[model samples]
Target: MPKKYLFYISQNYSFAILRPLQAEIQRRGGDVKWYLEPNVNASYLATDEEQLTTVEAVQVFNPFAVFVPGNVVPSFIPGIKVTVFHGFDAGKLDWKGKNTHFRVRGCFDLHCSYGKDMTKQFDALAETYKTFKVVDTGWPALDPLFTTDTALNPYISNKDNRPTVLFCSTFSPRFSCAPHIFDAIKKLSESGKWRWLVQFHPKMGADIVNKYKQLESENLTFIETDNVIPLLKSADVMLCDTSSVLLMFLLQRKPVVTFKGNQQGEHLINVSSPEQIESALIDALKQPDELMQHIDDYIKYIHAYTDGNSSARVLDAVDNFTFDSLKTKPLNLLRQLKLRKKLGYWKLS
Candidate 1:
């Protein structure tokens, strides 16, 4: 009998994160189903995909494992809970000034971590908690970036043969460069010296999104899409502020220019003022050897798995996990209650 798996998701972005894993599972003859939270749009599911609509439906499926891209998963679900994570840690801190990326929520049996730094952190956390295990499986969302052919990339249509720059930003008002750099970008876009592609986080303010949309011209395009791999592939350089998407871009071994980025490194060309945007882009497009080397060293520490087989590694980790040996997870009563109420499931079993 084939093993059964469940994908538990609360946000639309999880679709992109989990689809690669789903493909690997099906390739191995394992059965997979998705359980989307009510807040998530069901229309995002592909026509061939299957969804388990209710708590009862999920119970009936009784999957061998439940994969979650978000922080929490309902413990009542019949499976060994695994966390694949949603994004690369951009070193953002919580309101309390603690790194939230490594926070242990007591909800998962295994954490499929990416890169060497993250694995080391989680390995220490596992030693401290003794309730869960850690596995360095890289990130499945980036598999297509390495596996797909550049000729088939949909975002590379530059008829003018101008150097392309992709601009992206986080939605947080505190960290977003969108509001502050609008005038600089508008001026640059109108100059028609470079082709511009602007994409923002889905939660970005509509007013800010509209302003960029109005700037669209023969040289500028506003992109609205869930998958950013193509945008990363198409752009000669990326400009952003504090968004984890920049990490994804850097993995392409390209240069990135940031505006007041949360983390400063040799891998990035970080600027504090709008007046410096054009200069930074010019430098990034040149791809200086020192900057490119720094990016390569950073990639080794973060994610060295450029083989595009992270999904396969994730499945292998699941297959080899010793679930029975782990210590009992804490009874997080408040969080469990919130999930139960949110899902409207009252059954104790």
Candidate 2:
């Protein structure tokens, strides 16, 4: 019998991240089901691979493991709650006193960690909680970064002689570069010195997205798709601030200029203010080939598996999980309630 697994999808963009693992597990005769959240936009799901909405319905499927791309799985749901994580915990701190990047709220039985730093943190958590298992499986979401397929490009446009610049930002209003760098981008877009590509986190406000869309010109493209690998592939350099997408761009072994950014890495040109973006972009574009040595070190520190087999490693770990030997840990109800309230998901209670 195929080992049934439940993939808890809360956002449409998450589908791209977990699709590789889902396919690999199915190839091994495992059945993967998507448990869509009420707010989820299921337009990303191409086939009817079975989707459930309630915890009771999830129990009916009797999943051997529940893979959550998002945090806080329903407590009543039966299965080994596995936290696959949505993004790289690139040393970003949360408003709360606790480490928001890797805090364990007793919601997961297993944590599939990304790199050495993140893995070390989760491994410590595993030691503290005997029930929790930490696996150093490089992020499967980024597997496509190493692939050669070009059809998956989010933007379809004619190739030009001009160099490409990809501008990306995180969703957090406090840390986003969207509000600060529009003027600089607008000037660049109008100048036509290079082709511009803008892609933002899906959670970015529609108003912000629309504002940027209005500035779109012949040389500029405001991408609205969740897939960013192709954009990363085409770009000669990336510009951002504090977003994990910076790490994604680095995986391409290209130069990146970050504004007031935190995580230190080689070839990462960190600027103190928005006024420096223009110069940074110019420098990065000129020496696109300058940062390979540092980029390689950063990649190794962030992710160990760049061999395009991250999905396979994740599946192997899942297959080896001993369901009977492991006992589920009780949910930290207080913490869960607080987080839900903060995210406006408390009504779900």
Candidate 3:
């Protein structure tokens, strides 16, 4: 019998993160199916992709392993739960001043870490939890970034050969640079000195989204898409705030200009004022030696795999996992109840 795998997704972005792994699983003669929560749009599932809509359907499928990009998964489900995280640690803090990225929700059996820094942190967490194991398999989401041809990106339209600047921001009002930098971007786009592409987080405010959409012209284009990889490939430089998407752009060995980033990193050209945006973009496009060196160093620390084989590594880790010897995960009764209620699954099994 072929190995059966389940992909439990909660958001549209999960598709990009898990598709590479799906390809790898199918390549190995495995059957893969997706289970999208109510909050996630079912329309995002491609015609060729398979989906299990209800918890009952998922139980019937009897997958050998379940992969989740989010923090939590239904422990009652019949599978070895594995977590392939959604994004990089952009140093965003929670209400209690805790790093949100490393939080242990007691749901996963294995954490497929991105690189050395993440592996070290997860290793410590595993030692403390004693329920889950850490494996540094890099990130499958970035596999296409290294392997795909950027020339085919549909968004790239620099007919005049002008520098392309991609602007992206977080949705949170507290951390977003969108509101602050809009005027400056408007002026720059009007100047026609550089080509501009604006793509915002899906959860960004409608008012703000409309405001940027109005800036579309010969020099500027506002894009709305589930996948940002193509946009990342097309841009010469990226303009961002505290969003983790900047890390994805930096992995391409490119420079980024961030607006008052929450994380202090030498790898980014962080500007405190809107007035500084243009100069920073110019400097970033130049790609100075020191900035490029810092980017390289940070990439090595976060994700050193540029060979586009992270999906294979993730499968290998899953295959080698000692499921029989694993300890019991935390009960997490309240969380379990919440998940059950959300999925409308009443059975104890």
Candidate 4:
């Protein structure tokens, strides 16, 4: 018999990345299911019986090792579960194990870190975990963006994002933060110089939307929450600070503007002044060949996997790696030993 598995994500947003893995799992004769845990907010880490499975319940799934997003290893299903970081760097998924307020303890396994260099933010997470793997499975979200159609992407649902501008967070102070880059956008909106779409983090529901409402710009519509890919497509140009969402936009290779706060601050795009910001935006608006040259590298990073069929490649890697351990005990001691070492821990002593 094949292994039966229950796949879980903290929110609906992760579906794009997880779905391909899901299809791959099922293709291999493993049973797969999605666990939607409501009330699982960014502000809190307590897993609810309904919102998130209790530690005991996760154990019952008997997953042949689980694939989890980020490093906040939840105590639930502690025996199993690996981290599949859904972003470009390790900082994007910080589960210190000390911050119980943010993680359920053992909620992570191995993670990708978007193929980013592991020496910086990634080193600590690998040191802390007893078992973890870093594969170039690519950002789960990017898998769908490259493999699927624009119609499948939400921003272009209508086949057009007439004036969409996504408020992708910098994730600096916390998991995600609104960068000052958007202040420039608010200015144009207030003046009715341009119509835009400000999509905040799905986890940051209500708070940022309320702030947008306070801004009260009629030309700009504040989208509280929607899958960002579609909004990314709908917009002619994306204004953002240093973020991976810019990678997504490059998949479309659509015009993009880097948000440079001021001369004093740091940004992924080296925004030293309002002048540079205007220069970048103006050039992007004009469709300059100079800016077009960078799009090639952006696409390379966006599609880290060699093929657009990354879902298949990731699944193949997992399938070839998957074993019949489920037929024996819930886990193989050998595998468990390896897993323990992978997480940089002794087997629960």
lDDT by residue (tens digit), candidate 1, 1-349: 9999999999877898899899999999999999999888888899989999999999999999999999999989999899999899988898999988999999999999999999999999999999999999999999998998889777788366899999999999988999999999999999999999999998899999998999999889999876788889999999999999999999999999999999988999999999999999999999999999999999998999999999999999999998676899999999999999999999897
Per lDDT, what order, best first? 1, 3, 2, 4
Off by over 4 Å in 4: 27-29, 35-38, 41-52, 75-80, 90-109, 112-131, 152-154, 157-164, 171-183, 191-193, 203-207, 214-218, 261-269, 273-278, 322-349
lDDT at residue 326 of model 4 (Cα atoms) = 21
Q: Model 4: how far is 294 from its true place, Å?
A: 2.4
lDDT of 3 by residue, 102-157 (tens): 99999999999997988999999898878999999999999999998867779877
Candidate 2 residues lying further than 4 Å off, grouped into runs, are 96-98, 151-158, 288-290, 323-328, 335-349
Full-model lDDT, candidate 4: 0.51
User: At residue 245, what lDDT does model 2 achieve?
Assistant: 76
Please give each candidate's TM-score.
Answer: 0.97, 0.90, 0.98, 0.67
Worst 10 residues of 3 by lDDT: 151-160
lDDT of 1 at 14: 85
Rank ordering of all candidates by TM-score, starting from the highest: 3, 1, 2, 4
Q: Kindly give the number of clashing pairs for every candidate.
A: 0, 0, 0, 31
lDDT of 4 by residue, 220-336 (tens): 766644356557656777766545566577567666565442111111234554446655654566656656666655555435463455555555445455323222222345554
Q: Give the backbone clash total of model 4.
A: 31
Question: What C-alpha root-mean-square deviation, in Å, does candidate 3 show against the real structure?
Answer: 1.1
Each candidate: what lDDT?
0.93, 0.79, 0.93, 0.51
Error of 3 at 215 (Å): 1.1
